[model samples]
Target: MKDSWRRLAERLGGRLAFQAPLRELTSFRVGGPARMLARPEDVGELQELLASARRERLPFIMLGGGSNLLFDDAGFDGLVIKLGAGFAGLEGAGSLVRAGAAAASADLLAWTVARDLGGLEGLAGLPGTVGGAVAGNAGAGPEGLGRAVTRLFVLEGDGRARSIPAADLNFAYRRLEGLPERAVILEAEFALTSRPAVEIRARLAEIRERRGGQPLGGRSAGCVFKNPPSISAGRLIDECGFKGQRVGGARVSEVHANFILAENGATASDILALIDRVRQGVLARRGLALELELKVLGPGGEVRA
Candidate 1:
């Protein structure tokens, strides 16, 4: 059956739409078309869209800047809701920075450093939006976005908005396990200490310099494998001799094996194959099963195992 969404979206006059390409929204620049992609101009419009989707019993997924995601070549087959400029502003008070979920995480870091707010210097170069970072507890060792987040405003499954403490939210290594699927992160407030602006900026710069040795940029879903306890994923992949391994246009990054780099025109299937190859090699050599750090969005709204 044809979905009733297009007609409804058209009636809204560009507030939402259908069959949007996932490649452009994702950092990997791969994947196929989403069944529907809605850009709500405001919270009211978003609420309206959600209400409609719920009434129709249609599936929907919220997306930010789409970093840290590995979309299948076959893409998603459900509504992909993205909040744009209407939800991407930031404000601050003494030791607090409140940001809209859609606000770019990089912008938040820059703003914090400019204001002499300390504690997130280690996340200087991480890409994607604040909401995704908060959801994933994004960070390097000893510090993550969750640590700074004091409060989060979430639109829960029942369509009620609730304010919650970060500690109350379920956040673990690269995943928020217990949040209801229908919940849409609206905004968050983070705590930071006042510091010398110059010092904070310098520390951010140092992080950037340190991360320079790793492969970033190009079409990638960031780190492909989660670090196992007491060891790094990159080091293990390198040890398995899978660096520079290629299948079609997807290859394990020679610079950092844990990261898979897609040459132009690569498909998500290619990357998936490479991921399997890396895992097999690592498992065979070390008898350890490596878990994924990136979320893989698959076709027909099917959950990827």
Candidate 2:
């Protein structure tokens, strides 16, 4: 199956590599490598690759900005599909904005703001691609991308494109429940209200202010644990005295307890160990079972529990 992807990549002119090091692919910067990695430039190429992988029964996982994700030290055995420049396009009219999957979240936010579009300003400091944000329903506070999104352009395993209404894409806290596990998001359209430029700028500034004290820039996947019930995971962890805790090179950020920062030299094992330690601590001391918010990819690009 690995060789199959390589051969297809050669034929399709898609970027392909064997044993591609993924340490630099993620924000965490603590992964090993991927057995196979393919970056498709366009929807046609992505569909072709997906079709081929499906025919060969080869598992694959979509990788966007590499934010909010962690890869294991052993590396992924399946193909890691990434969208390229062809999917980074952005176009909009009046109060509607259309963006490609590869478009950066920050760029999208800025583009809309420049046009006096109001909807996604809450994502000002978020680090991820449009596709990832939509897939995970990313947000700051109560505002999520799902609220602004009106439509989605997706491709199925059969290489067929479909336009789905946002209402059909039932979104919840950090989850897009209506989307199937195998469906690939190619582009999304957002419906926003026309607002004054000053208002947009003010909202962006407010978000920036609220982001204070959090390690917005770091070698870490945003938040480690999700907010439980009514309280935040950071507050709980801080109350448990886990702030500034270290496990090898991975340490809980003093500024934000939910974030675990990686230093000059850190291993995937170190991050995993730290996460386990925190979970154990919270469960034993606080009687709270922490749930992971960030996605952790196993050796085969499989979801790690």
Candidate 3:
């Protein structure tokens, strides 16, 4: 199987990411390595790669900027495809902004704001790529990314390209729960409001400052658990007295219980175990089970159980 993939890579003139360490790609700096990492130069290349993987029945993952993800220590054994140059641009005018999937969320938001776009300001400081943001329908306060998304261009699981509308797209709290797992977001067109660039810039700065007030920016996924209706996950964890709890190298952030920090040789397993403890603590004390916002991918190239 490895030889076949290698031959394919050679034919395509694309480099392979063999035993690529997930720790290096993620914000947490944890997780095991992936068996293969493939970066496609264009959408055609991506589709061809997916077709080959499907034909070979090889399991694979579509990796974005690796911000809102937790990978296990076992490492993935399948292919990991990360989009590049072709899917990392920003260009648009009027009330619509066209952004590439691999574009950083911060950069996309900034681009929109520079044009005086108002809708994306709510998501100013969110991490990850535009594709990840769209896939997760990421948001802050009472707004979500989907609210601004008018149309999405996606590479389907069947190696086909199609356009989907916001009405047809399904989204939930921190989850682009409805899009087919096999589909890859290529670019997204957001319908936003025009405002003064200065005002938009100020709003962006304000939100950045707000996120700065939280326990973010460490080697950790942005927010570990999603807030339940009418309750914040961080508050619940803090109320449970689980803040600053440590297990091995993983520590629940004292500043924000929802954030689990890794220090001094923290492993993916440590973070996973700490997550379990936090969830258990919250459930035991508040009788409320919290859901994780970060997608936990296991080693051996499988989604976390």
Candidate 4:
């Protein structure tokens, strides 16, 4: 396997590593190392890397800003591909904005606001890249990134590149459905509205202020669970007296119950255990199962509990 990986790295020209540490790459700061890590410069490089991985029969997964992900302590045993600086392009033409999947959500939001694009102000303080946000349908309240997206460019699992229109996309609460297996989003175009720059900045400021109460200073993966229909997940957890609750180095944020903060020396297992405890508590007391908004991944990129 190491020989295969070495050959693959040589074929792709460089920017590859063996047993790369993943804890610092994520917001939670608790993951282990990935067996192989690849940083692809552009779409062409990404496609080549993907095809090579397929031919080599090596598992692969994409890593964006690593904001809402939880990698297991054992780490991923496959190729972890992260987009490089070449994929972070952002530009706007009229009310239509084009952004690379690697572009930061905050950067995209700022670009839109500078051009008086009103729709993306809601993404002002959101972490992660534009692709991750769109993939997860990230939002504040009922509004989401999908609503602003008009088109998407993706490299599908079978090494085919295609553009999908918003009309054909299926976006749900906290998730985008119907994407082809192993597809990677390369770029997205958003249809925004023309608004005054002052108004856009004010709206952005308001949204940022609203998120101020979240435990921003701590190491957290933002919200831990998705809000149940008509109810806030944070409120539910707070009602269950889970604020400041701790399990090992992981603790529920007192500022916001939905956030689970990781202290120094926290392990991915600690976070997972705390998540299970909270889920069981919420289920036992409220009779409602809190669904996770945070994505948890095992060593093989499989979803973990």
The prediction achieving the highest TM-score against the true structure is 4
* TM-score of candidate 1 against the unseen true structure: 0.94
- Candidate 4 weakest ten by summed lDDT: 1-10
Worst 10 residues of 3 by lDDT: 296-305
Write down the TM-score of every candidate. 0.94, 0.96, 0.95, 0.96
Q: Best candidate, lDDT-wise?
A: 4
lDDT of 2 by residue, 1-305 (tens): 45666677677563877788888888998888887788888887788788877887777888899898899889887778888889999999889999999999999999998888998987889998999999888998744789999999999867888899987878788878887668899999999999999998988899889888689777988988888897899999999999999988999999999999998788888999999999999999989999888899888667865
Q: What's the TM for model 2?
A: 0.96
The TM-score that candidate 4 achieves is: 0.96
Off by over 4 Å in 1: 1-7
Best-to-worst ranking by TM-score: 4, 2, 3, 1
Residues 1-305 of candidate 4: C-alpha lDDT, one tens digit per residue? 55756776787666888889998889998888998889988777788778778987778888898999999999998889899988889988889989999999989988887777889876877889998999999977666889888999999977799999988888888899878889999999999999999988787788889999888899998898999887899999999999999989999999999999999888999999999999999999989988889999988889753
Residue 182 lDDT, candidate 3, scale 0-100: 83
Show model 4 residue runs off by greater than 4 Å: 2-4, 11-14
Error of 2 at 146 (Å): 0.6
Question: Could you tally the backbone clashes for each prediction?
Answer: 0, 0, 5, 0
lDDT of 1 by residue, 1-305 (tens): 24556566766667565667889888888888887788876777777778777887777888888888776777777788888788898999888989999988889888888788998775688888888988788886534667677888888856778888876776677766556667899898989999998888777778888788678767787788788997998998898898899989998888878888889879999988988888888999999899888887677555554
lDDT of 3 by residue, 1-305 (tens): 56767777786664566787778888888878887788887877787788878888878888888888887787787888888877899988788889999999889887877677798987777878998888878877645788888889998888989998888876666667557678889999998898988888887788778787577757888788888897888888898998888889999898888888889899988888898988887888889988878888865555553
lDDT of candidate model 3 versus the reference: 0.82
